[model samples]
Target: MGSILVVMENGTGGFVDSSKELIAKAKDIAKALGMSSVAIGFGSEAEKNLKGLSVDRVIAVSNPELTQYHPEAYEKALAQVLQKDQPFLTLVANTTMGMDLGAGLAARASLPLIAYCSQLSVEGQEVLATSSVFAGKLMAEIVVPESGAVISVMPGQWPQDTDRGDPPIDRMSLDLPSSMKILQLIEPEKGDVDITKAEILVSVGRGIDNPDNLPLAEELAEAIGGVLSCSRPVVDAGWLPKSRQVGKSGQTVKPKVYMAFGISGAPEHQQGMKDADLIIAVNTDENASMMDIAHYGSTVDMLDLMPALTERLRGE
Candidate 1:
């Protein structure tokens, strides 16, 4: 059996949610393939962050320059590791950093790269993968034709590893080439109510009509004790923050209850919310695809129903 090398970002703190999910998927895939799985971390304090994983080993490329995430440094270090390990398959989380490094590695190494993979399985020498297409309206299965395949998986789509079995983390270090220089690091803005962890979500759409009309949606969300989210149009119209946008370009939410109001389900918007356990759509149009997929739906306008529902919910 060949070795499976899983790449971990090992961010400033511990591993990010996506990286943790990658480790979990790597372990599961490795077990299925009957091969050993190892997690490779590239950061200055990687050992402190990645030592908690249940993997067989944790390889660190700890250097001061490696602390901040830069495309050049990451590509150079990871490419060297890939060449050295020569594993059967390399797995990375489907995040901005992971995708960039995965693409760079694929180009430099001339390996088959599968990006944004939703599902993966091993079939003999082939690593079969499935990607959601047409805004997650369809599933397409594919196989990497190259010997050493590189795959980047989407976060929150896979579960994280919790169990710690035998064969504790074997810490190994790697020396990197001093060609690349570390530059300034810029921190991005943070979002409120990280939708990835929220079990309940109340999503609004164009049905609300105007920014002034959002009080009702807020009331519904308040009654339900969950944050209010919306479609791209609502966020684009300044009715809500971009963080609250739920779609392919926005956040992918897998909430326990995804209540959609006035939003005609577009493929791009639906893809992000399709994983919700129970979907409820409030739309007058009965023929809407949202109603078809929604476990519960109402034919009346959310505008008319909002006040009464809010009052009733408040009364109860």
Candidate 2:
């Protein structure tokens, strides 16, 4: 069996949480397959981040052209590393950069590509990867028969392994083409609150009905000393900003307690807050998808329950 290759990404401070999740998963897959795991880093900063991860080896691809992220440059550099290493399974985080890089590398190498994988395992000799489809309504398992396959693992699916010590880093020089140049990197506007750091989140969904009903959720959040967050629909409806949205496309939060109101529990939304210590979901429908992962489920009307729950918490 060939080695498992994890393509890591660096963020503002160091490695992104998704990259750490990939590294942990990659280590598990490598151990299961009786193969070593190797992490591929782009630059010096990435190398520094990769060192702290628990992997067999870290390959740092350094080049002046690799400073800023360019899709073509990343593809070319990763293609060279892949050709040389030829790992059995290449993993990348299912992030913005990972999505672009994974697709480009898969296309460039003509390898099988799997995206948004939440679960992975080895059944006999076949590599099975499970991902959600139809907006988290159905789960699809992909089987890769080829030796070299590229998989983009979703963020927040696997927990980060922080117990491991620093691994040895090997520097590789790559001759990148000067065709594509990044002119400027524009950052998104910052939101009022960073929901990712919130210890408690009172999240609402489309079931809230009207924008006027938002104050009820806010009152509940405040009553419990928690922050008010929402699903994607709430943000789309202009009831909440994008910063307060929790899902795969939004913020990934691992709060101590997550209370869901009127949320159907789509897979995209579940991926974000599923790791919370305590998940309590209240919806009209008992058979809703949100109930599937909730620690405690309530089949009560959220509109009626919110006020009462808030009042009870406030001892009013």
Candidate 3:
């Protein structure tokens, strides 16, 4: 039986959450296909982290040149692993590093590549993956025609794997070319507030109309003792900093209460804040995607609603 291979990612202290989520999905696919799940990671620290994963085996590829993430170096290392094992399915996170390496690895291995996969299933003998299209207005189901297919799974679509057991670790090495090197790692500016830990989030989107009206949302958030957050458009428009942005490309937040004002609820934005305990959305369009996931929704104009809501919350 062909094995399911998962490419693990390295984070500050351990593997990233997306990597574990892919492993969880890979385990499910492997079970249905009657195959074993194998995980390949880089670095000795990654080997220590992989010991807790539930995969059948963990291959840790270590090299001096791989101390940091270099796109070409990763592509070369992954290509060597894929060439040797030739697994039925290869899974990577649809993250910055994953997207960088996924296409190159697929082309190098001569396999089909699927990206932004939110769901995967085995239909008959073929593996089918579902991904969002058209700004998440539609979902497209893609079928991998043959084995050795590579897929980049989107984060937050599946629950993270919690099974903690020591998996057998296999050590390996790679000779990376000196031509590939990271010049520098420039980190983004740290925001004054960390929205990820906010108990309540009052977020805005394009529906707010203008950046000049941001104070209205800020007033409401302050009244409710909540942090001010926003969708990608708000950040893109420069009304809010990227730290305030909540979405797949921004921050994944799980606040106790998420109050969205004038947000259209695109899948990318929803993936970040969908796990909130209480979702309350206020949009003029009652049929907005935000309303679909909201526990309580109001079809009122946010321009009029924000001031009144702020006053009411302040009065209480």
Q: For candidate 1, which ten residues in a row score worst on lDDT?
A: 165-174
- Residue 207, model 2: lDDT of 94
Candidates ranked by lDDT, best first? Answer: 3, 2, 1
TM-score of 2: 0.83
Q: Highest TM-score, which number?
A: 3
lDDT per model vs. reference:
0.77, 0.84, 0.86
Top lDDT hit:
3
TM-score of each: 0.71, 0.83, 0.89
Give the alpha carbon lDDT tens digit for every residue of 1-99 in model 3.
Answer: 789999888878888889989888889989998888999887657667778888888888766456567788788878887888889888999887888
lDDT string, candidate 1, 1-316, tens digits? 5678888875656677777777787887778877778887766677666666788777777765676666776777677767877777888877767878899988887788877687888788567898755544456799866587898887677777777644345454545556666556544223766766777777888889989889988887888787788898998888788788887678888899998988888756775898799999999988676886799999898898877787888896
lDDT of 2 by residue, 58-83 (tens): 88876645656778878987888788
Where in model 2 is the C-alpha error above 4 Å?
47-57, 64-68, 157-180, 183-190, 314-316
Residue 145 error, candidate 2, Å: 1.3
lDDT of 3: 0.86
Identify the superior model by TM-score, candidate 2 or candidate 3: 3
Residue pairs clashing, model 3: none
| Model 3 residue 253 distance off true place after TM-score fit, in angstroms | 1.8
